[model samples]
Target: MAGTVQNREAFLNQIAERLGRPRITKPVERPNWNFRPQDEVLKSATQDELLEVLKEQCKRIHTTIYTTDNSELSSVLNEVVTNYGGGPIVTWKDERFSHWGLDSLMKQEWPNQDIHVYEWDHTKGEENIAKAEQANVGITISEITLAESGTVVLFSDENKGRTVSFLPATYIALIPKSSIVPRMTQAAQKMREIHQNTGHVASCINFITGPSNSADIELNLVVGVHGPVKATYIVINDL
Candidate 1:
């Protein structure tokens, strides 16, 4: 037993030595855009008109909107759980998420209903995958996404587990409006900055647009084959 343990330790040390330490990269310069502009215009006569447009879009897309005073993150999450038909809601093991009152919401909203809240730290790899596979909806707070093309970028990290966002049936992302950029190039620049600051780059960086969809067979569009069937973004302007 002692010999076996020594062998195992030696193997682990060899692997660690081979892996070495993570080295940080220098930040890359931002790219320039030279694209032609399209002539798309929206003429809204009143606030009611603009709201009507937003409502129509939301309804057409089968999405729900919950606005809170930034202080009411818990209330917003609670309302989402209640209205969206209770199911497994997956989040990361981040303090901000907990501080925003996800734990309380989980306790209150789950037991009474058939819903479950699964939190993963990514270190629990196989366990996280199991939870993600069984989950109905995955909730994540993104670093940024582009509004024009409706693109969400996820840098692989412990808190923002990639499987939680990709394996679930529905994905609900909470993004602060301030994080929104005008173009994808800007998003790439931001990512490069993050990579420079951190020594290790994410194992995977996923860019999601709309939901998992394909129009491969007979030109018939199919959804949910690759990932979530539905994707919703809750943009919090305040936070």
Candidate 2:
């Protein structure tokens, strides 16, 4: 009942009557593009090359990017979190953190250093929101990283709330090198694949570039005006 469309049939019928034709109820197949320049851009670049593109875009977006292998990932993460004034750190309830070899650091090492950690729990509801708002840093694993625009794509779920990334003073993303794509063209294709293969997709998908930035009516440039004042991404080469 939460998302039920009560008047959709009637509304679509009215539009069909205006057009003197039947409403389109079937999904249409996407057309083939003869010349898609987007797909051609950065298509041949290797993973290291894509990393370079991401590094350059990070400068424009005012984001700090770090590259390391799996063996050094946890160290890099610790360094960035500390640089952002350390915890209380809010993160998604994701197993990838453990799998990527950060279990001890996140669960034990940080806490031993007096850095509080809160893993978003669905059962807590608004309790999680409060924690996120007060958290000094929010960290999450990037579902898809785009090199062209230096964007981190997130698909929110029960264990992953939007606020974990939006409400904190600082944000950090753990990007697996394999997750890096040439650009949004590839990212969109991946999303399409997920929908086709899984029969569903997350309700909310976020494409975050960096810390919030805006220019006011006076034409003065402002940074971190809406969200986290700092954004950093750590790319694990062997993850």
Candidate 3:
């Protein structure tokens, strides 16, 4: 986020010039809204309670959720992969996979059996997307999870390919119990915290809720419209 250049002034000045008005460069204070995202729904809920909220919301979003501890995560992951038809799999180049003992599962165990696991490498550039598109399952760890909306927040970077979540037939998000928050309000605060303390934050943030859902003229809910046909959230109870 720090290295990126946002052309805010130039973009705004062009619009002002077209409208025949002097550019207003100085920032103006905005009025606070009557309602806030953090207002009252389980704002003070404990982590266990928040997990319940997330579970209920996932039902509405039609996303499957699985709870497993660190020791059982590998087996659980294997189960999900098998359930989704034993993939040509892709995952982020995240060290957390090693921390949670999944590195060997993908890099060694799965590939040896011809499951074909691909990790997103920065040098691959756009080729990564091609791999993702052909993959049956794409896995990513949730950066900050919003329980209220059943959304997993992903911050894309060199190690994390954004399209890994978009093009794959199925998307898997590994959400640690510690990363689960009550709502989007807390997720925004977490983003601000990252911006204030670190320079490694990715320029883009994606808030994905369940699988891609669309509707026709009759307003019938059709899951898996344009994006991933299936989305699963594996919530680690103890990370």
**CA RMSD of each candidate after superposition:** 9.4, 1.7, 2.8
State the lDDT of candidate 3 residue by residue for 77-173, as single tens digits: 9998999998899899999999898977888889887899989998978889899989999999898998889999999988898988988899899
Judge candidate 1 against the unseen true structure and give its global Cα lDDT, from 0 to 1.
0.67
lDDT accuracy of residue 222 in candidate 2: 91
Candidates ranked by TM-score: 2, 3, 1
Writing each residue's lDDT as its tens digit, candidate 1 over 176-210 gives 65665554666776778877998556777887775
Better of 2 and 3 by TM-score: 2
In terms of lDDT, the poorest run of 10 residues in model 2 is: 1-10
Tens digits of per-residue lDDT, candidate 2, 112-175, equal 9999999999999999999999999999889999999999999999999999988999999989
* Winner on TM-score (1 vs 3): 3
Judged by lDDT, which candidate is best?
A: 2
Name the weakest run of 10 consecutive residues (lDDT summed) in model 3: 35-44
- Residue 223, model 3: lDDT of 76
TM-scores for every candidate against the unseen true structure: 0.68, 0.94, 0.88
Candidate number that wins on lDDT, 1 or 2: 2
Candidate 3: where are CA atoms >4 Å away? Answer: 1-22, 30-37
Which of 1 and 3 is the better model by lDDT? Answer: 3
- Mark the regions of model 2 whose C-alpha exceeds 4 Å error after superposition: 1-3, 19-21
